[model samples]
Target: MNTFGMWRLARKYDKFPTPEEKPYSPFNRQEPQEVFDGTQVYSWAAGTAEFAHRGAVLLRPLPEDPAPGRWLGYKDTVRGPALDWHTDLGVIRLVHCGDSKAATDVASAITSNGNKDGVVTVCALYGDMGFHGPALVAADTAHPGIEYEASWGDVAALVGQVLPWWPDLLRLPSVIREWKPDAQAAVVEVPANDNEKILCRAAANDVFDVTSRVAATDMANSIRNNQVDHTSHEIEIFCKDGYSETPNQVVAGAVPDTSHHPLPCDGDREALKAGWHKLALHTHPDAVAALEVAVGREPNLLPFGAVTEIPVRPGTISDRWTQRLTMCDPTAAHAVLAQDDKAEAFFIGPLTDMPVLRTPGDDGKQVWRFYAPLSLPAGGPELASVVLHHTLWVITSDGHVHPAPCTPTEHLWWGDGWGDRASEAAAVVDQLLDDLGATVDLHEHWNAPKGLTALFNEEHKKGAELTRAALLHARMTPPRTR
Candidate 1:
């Protein structure tokens, strides 16, 4: 019989004002009774009549006046549908009573709503009376939507559950940078070579290789000079010197150690002299001296015999058999050597033996050297020729090559990996090849022993009919005049 009991008693009648309505005081009453429809229906009764210090009780009017003779018994206040059990109003009304027993009874009555209907009710029981201040109690029940069913601890947990989407609800700035198409637009300028402009103009697309254009210019120059003519009587060499069956051939007379030094019996001396002159003009004197030592001769002396005919490309002698050799362009020497069938097994070898007399160190130290030919094949009687010398020896007890090693040109492109600039050059080559209607598979030859020939054979076998059809189409089409 407290505030909550009074509220329950007030809510029982259909004529009672909703809990949402404001309370009104009766003319004679000290405490206010909530009113509806201008009727003074609800009232508080002193609970001292029922139990001491229990505060006041509440009563509701009976539906019909009490039956004539029989004494009318009052029933406990019945909850109504208008009372939201999930809300804190019912709980607030119950727990605000002055007496602990009354508050406990009110809490029991609210919780009992679960049995009457599906609604579950709960109440906060403060341990200390001081904590049950009016403001604190009102604050707990202030929000209309949330019901104060349980203790503060449970309320905190409920708040956390209700606020689950709070973090997701907040606005966040984008982490990724927004790039506009126009902002990214830029012009890349390529440095020009001799024929770069011409190639770029002739290119079907805007893209062209500046370096390849230079190389093509050199090639065109060579063609003009009759150096690389298909009709030229160029000697092709197939050599097999038995040191080890390595990929690159070992140069004769290049090792300082004279063990298996090949003499300058043929055109080797002139070739050696030419290679030295070529190298001396471009390289440092110390490097030239190193080259001479590798060739088993002084820098001043020539190594080839006068009677032997010196071909631009030196032939290899395996068991006294000689053949013609085809020379590689100086700029493309490394690429040519790397792709050569004979130069695949071992990483080290001499490019040309005739022009350079290279030797291993006298003390059995490993050394290799290159000599620029005295007369370049392009300018001289020889169309194209140069010698490469390789020297191999055992390492000293300290695991170092003796007689000091010779450094090759830094500009030579021999290694597998290239920097950004070289990669761009290779890409240009690929693009040019594509435009020329050529399917250039450089890696296939690089990986296999038979090289490009083997790849061509494989492709021919696999796509013979397709290739024939392409050929037929080519024959039927008229050549376009530019």
Candidate 2:
């Protein structure tokens, strides 16, 4: 057909004549300015102001009667409530939506047409402008008046300087040091007309630029005022290279380079001799307490457990990797252990974190030796490796814990792939023990007593050996090749 004829023919059977829907187009959209009123943007701060840390604190009107709330969502080991996964992720996606659509984006919506009977209020520890997730209400019965809030990291009782609201909301809640309201105020600046571009740039990238600057300013002031005392905890560090008296902060940041520091308990050992460190935290119970306060129980790979006498609290001593090897107030006391008659000292931190000691051999010359459990012919693939830690500590009255290089008993590492090849791995361990016995004496204070040691005595070694076995198996296993 001709062009005009085809057009007419196609038009004759079109659904448009019967009023069909048309496709959407950009022209169909309306101006967003229709309901946007700057004056209508009444000052809205999410939570009540219990306290402020200068710019860190956005002063909000206090609630008439703030209700007392309990801390929740914390692991039993941690002192405070945990921060939520989203807070850790630091994701922020703002949307322009009304009450109905708002629920889709925000876990807890703060605005209501002003009928305050729905959601109960709570003071959260650390959150972005105190905005918790959507109110804890059922979808069908949820009310607009009640704002939703569920924060993980903030324990209500925790009090510290203000933290920045950012991609990730991290709060440092310790005892509040010197208040730096003046310092915080000094850094607060009104963005100049020329600084619009700078503000825009920061907005594009750093979610918490202003808050960061404010925090930095406050922190600087604290330092200048001598408030942030960078006190070092006295410790005797031992490692393969050498032993030295260093601060806790220095070694806390050491790379957990397992290759260089394969903690006897953490991985396999082929060479009977290994290099490790002894961090002399034995004398500093206050340092220990500071460490516990600083760590507050994050995820730990291995925790060496023991039951000690002081107050007799049974707990695990392990590396709190997240504390980043920090030092806290020496005055901050922690519960220390003291046996009925014996010197009670427990190994603290991760096995890999301590300093390596120079062990003395029976040969008299300086030796690189680790006294570990001797695995005799025993059943199970489990006994194929050595334990993690082999030393117990004794704190002196004078607060000086000299590193005593002790070998203690430990098993030898044999390759895996046998379920009950006790004979194979055990024989290897026996031979190692015989060699060490001939070369080094076990009766010496450096080594633990021979034969099957007590459960408490071999506990650390057992844990270490198991971890070593697992790690050894992983290392020994050949990777799949295409």
Candidate 3:
């Protein structure tokens, strides 16, 4: 005769021998339909089977050292994705509902056993699954889920204790064999695509402390939430779609603002002979007026011009090196398609306060020591149509046009990149960017430039890598309902 009660384990285990002391549910779990897996046992009753049911419960009792007290209880099992990977893999799960960070803590604890004697790997879910199955299962109301797999040796580690009456769940159609390739003189490794990632920042818990899985719903909600009301603390978003947040609006996959970037030093040349993208100097009103006809410049941001050589600095070529910073007449900016050379190619950028000035000790500064670049607008017609999208491009020069991409905000359009000129322009832009610590592509060929692949610093690199993660999040996260 068998009796049923609360079969409390001193600690967590794989199975038991008889009818569970605690029996409230029924033995109804059918094994995975695809395969007759024998490794797993029953879900509710104390029995092993060629296949395990869906609601398989497992025990993970508290340890003695920490004195879990009332917190220690039966650990629930996570089933394979009910719908698809949209839920989670069919790996083992361990749910804990303790506090706000309870799920996170439990995930960490479970991860500790990964690759252990009986564990294979552990991971957080792609999204938080709803609870309609059973209690004591490891899960959150609307948080992330944890996924872990048992070693082949213990593939049935999630099955309840194997009782004498339990059917054999270990005779699976699948075989768990070790993969051992013969030693090679040189083993080749395959490369994984670096573009994969989540596009949203973690607004909540961090399961892996690396990249948190968010649902598509959460991502759209996050975008709208950021628009309606910004949060106090939120991680930065990756711009796989070329996202740029402006003062008035958030631009996604649009043109970057180039009306005017901040310029200080009041165009003071002496103080900017090396690098002073940081030194603030008021921008001269005359310079602003000259640039206004072509581009937009920030009202503030100007302490003084760092390259003070007349608001319209002229470009000069010395010893095959060009120190070009000339203020061409706004009328020369453009004409009717056939009026002139079309003057359509524009490459806008910041004029280094210390153009042509080389810091003797600075290694990166050597290139500019020889060639001074004539920065131009980034817009206008081009040979190879490459770069990200921005705003509407109206003819801003020729009396009807304003100096864009090249305004005080961005300097006005000038500079030719036909032959060596383009290469020269590239060098100038590079040095300026290096000095200013500006990350993002000066080339602007790829609107959605992959993260740090084009960046130089750690912060920028980290951000780019996170974009892959964010892309994942954006794709996976669902739209918020309420």
Best by lDDT: 1
lDDT tens per residue, model 3, 1-482: 12222234212334543332333345746432222121122222322342222222221221223221111112332421111011112333322121243433444544544512222122222222212111122331112243222121121222221100000111111110111122111211111111111222221323212211222112323333332222111101211212224111111111122122121113323232211122111132222222222122221222221121111112311211122323222221111111222232322223433222222222322222111122223333221111111110112122121111211222211123232122211222233222322221234422222222222111221112222233233324443433
Using all chains and alpha carbons, the TM-scores for the candidates as numbered come to: 0.13, 0.19, 0.20
* Residue 284 shift from truth in candidate 1, angstroms: 17
lDDT of each: 0.24, 0.23, 0.22
When sorted by lDDT, best at the front, the candidate numbers are 1, 2, 3
Q: Model 1: what TM-score?
A: 0.13
Model 3, total clashes: 104
TM-score of 3: 0.20
Off by over 4 Å in 1: 1-355, 361-368, 373-376, 379-409, 418-482
Q: Per-residue lDDT of 143-217 in model 2, one digit per residue for the tens?
A: 222233322113111211122121111111221121122122111111122222332232233333333223222
The residue-by-residue lDDT of candidate 1 on 238-316, one tens digit each, is 1122233422121111102122222222234444455433432222323233333323323233222111111122322
Q: Report backbone clashes per prediction.
A: 35, 39, 104
A best-first ranking of the candidates according to their TM-score comes to 3, 2, 1
**Comparing 1 and 3 by lDDT, which wins?**
1
